[model samples]
Target: MTNITKENFDKAKNFYNFDTLYAPVLPGLKATVMKHQDAITDAFYKELANDEIAAKIVAGRVDQLKATHKVWMEELFNGEYGEAYFNRRYKIGETHVKAKIAPYFVEVITSSLRRSFAQILVAEGAVAVQAALAILDLDAMIIIGAYHEDRMHRMSDVTGMNLNLLETLMSFG
Candidate 1:
C-alpha cells in the first residue's frame, strides 16, 4: 500500500474547503445519509443490473455485495474522517482494482450514491453545497489514489522484469 501522509490528507481537506461550515452539519448529514441508505444501494444495484460490464463483475454475488455496500455507506457517514476512514476508502478502491472491475463502474456507482445523498440532504433542508461536494470529492480522491497506486505498482513490477531481461540479453551479447 502506498503510504498516504497526514500532510497529503490535510492538504486535500483544505483544497476541498472542508472547513468549519462543513463540520456543523456532520451529524445531520450522517443521519440523512443513513436514512436513505437502502434507496441508494437499491438504485446502485438497479443501475448495475442493467450494465453488462457491472453485471458481469457482480454476477452471482449480488446479495453479498449489497450487504457489504450497505456497510460501506454506513461507514461513509459515520462522521469520523480520520485515518481509519481514509484507509477504508483506499481499501475499497484497491478491492475494486484487484477484482478486475472497470473504473467506470466505480464512478457510476459512486455518482449515484452521491446524487441520492444530495437529494436527501436537500429534502431535509440541510443543503450545504460545499460540504456535500467536499465529501464526494474527498471520497473520490482517496479511491482514485488507491487505483493509481495499484496501477503504478503493477507497472513498476513489469518495468523491472523488462529491465532484467534486457540486462540478461546484453550480457549474452
Candidate 2:
C-alpha cells in the first residue's frame, strides 16, 4: 500500500482543491451530513445486504460495519482531509483486501454511498454538493488505489517479482 505521507496527502488536497473549494462549504456540509448520517449508513448497509454474496460477506458484522461506516461517512464532511485522513482511508482499502473483497465491490459501495447521500447533499446546493463529492471522490479513489496496490504488493511478495514485471504479467492475454 502507498504510504500516506504529507507530500502525498498534500498532492491529493491540491488535486481536489481542498482548500479553496472544499473547505468553504465543508462546515455546512458537515452539519448536514452529520444530521443525516444515520440514514446514509443504514441505506448503505441495506444496499450491501441486498446482494447475496455481499450479504454473506457482511453477514455477522453488520453492526460493526455500520458503526465504522458511520464514522467514515461523517469524517468525509469534517473538513480535515489531512495525512491522518488519508491513512484512515488507505486502511479502509487494506481492510477490504484482508476481507477478500473484490475491487468491483468498491465501485458498488461507492455507488451505494452516492445514492444514500446524493439527494440530501443536493439539497445543500451545487457548491456544497461539489465539495462533498470531492471528499467522497477522494475516499473512493484512495480505497480503490490502495486495494490494487496492496494486492499487487502481495502478489509480488509471493512470486518474488518486482511490481513492474507483475504488472506486465497481469496485462498478458
Candidate 3:
C-alpha cells in the first residue's frame, strides 16, 4: 500500500515537473480523442441537438459554431493550454452568449467533457490515464475557474450592472 501510494504520488508529481515526463503519458489523451473525435462529436451534437432547451438555443448557430468547437477540442488534445488558449475559451463563452445559448449548456459541455475523458481513459488504460487525468483535471479546473471569473468580472464592468443580483436570484441553483 505504501509503495502504491508513493508510486501514484510520484506519477502525479511529474505533471508539474516541467519536463517531458508527462509528455508521453498524454498520448493516451490525444490518441484516443484523435481516433474517436467523430464519435465524440456525434455524441455531443446529438445531445445538444436533441436537447429541448439547448436545441432551440443552438439552432441556426450550429454550422458556424461547429468549426469553433472543433478547434477548441483539437486544441485541448494538442496540449496548447496557454494564455492565448484561455483567451479563445472566454471568447467562445461570449460567443455562446451572443448566440443566445443558455448558461445551462455550460453544464452540458462539462458533462460531455467528463464522459469523453472517461471513454478515452478506458480505451487507453486505467492506471496511467487515471493519474494523468487527475493532473489534467486539476489543472483544467484551475485555469477554467480563473478564466470564467475574469470573464464574468469583465462582463459586469462592461454592462455596468451588478451580476451578483442575478446570481443571488439563482442561489438555489
Candidate 2 positional error at 38, Å: 1.6
Off by over 4 Å in 2: 3-12, 164-173
What tens digits encode model 2's per-residue C-alpha lDDT throughout 118-160?
Answer: 6888876788777776777777788877776887888889989
Better of 2 and 3 by lDDT: 2
Could you tell me the TM-score of candidate 3? Answer: 0.61
lDDT (tens digit, per residue) of candidate 3 on 45-135? 7788887987787678777767665666676655544445445654555555566565566655666766676766775676545544544
Each candidate: what lDDT? 0.72, 0.78, 0.57
Which candidate leads the pack in TM-score?
Answer: 2
The deviation in Å at residue 84 for candidate 1 is: 0.9
Task: State residue 71's C-alpha deviation in candidate 1, in Å.
Answer: 1.2
Q: Model 2, 21: alpha-carbon shift in Å?
A: 0.6
Which pairs of residues clash in candidate 3, taking residues 3 or more apart in a chain or in different chains? none
Model 3: weakest 10-residue lDDT segment is 1-10
Clashing pairs counted in every model: 0, 0, 0
lDDT of 1 by residue, 65-166 (tens): 999988877666556787788888888888888898877777767787667777777755654544665677677778776776676567668776453354
TM accuracy, model 1: 0.81
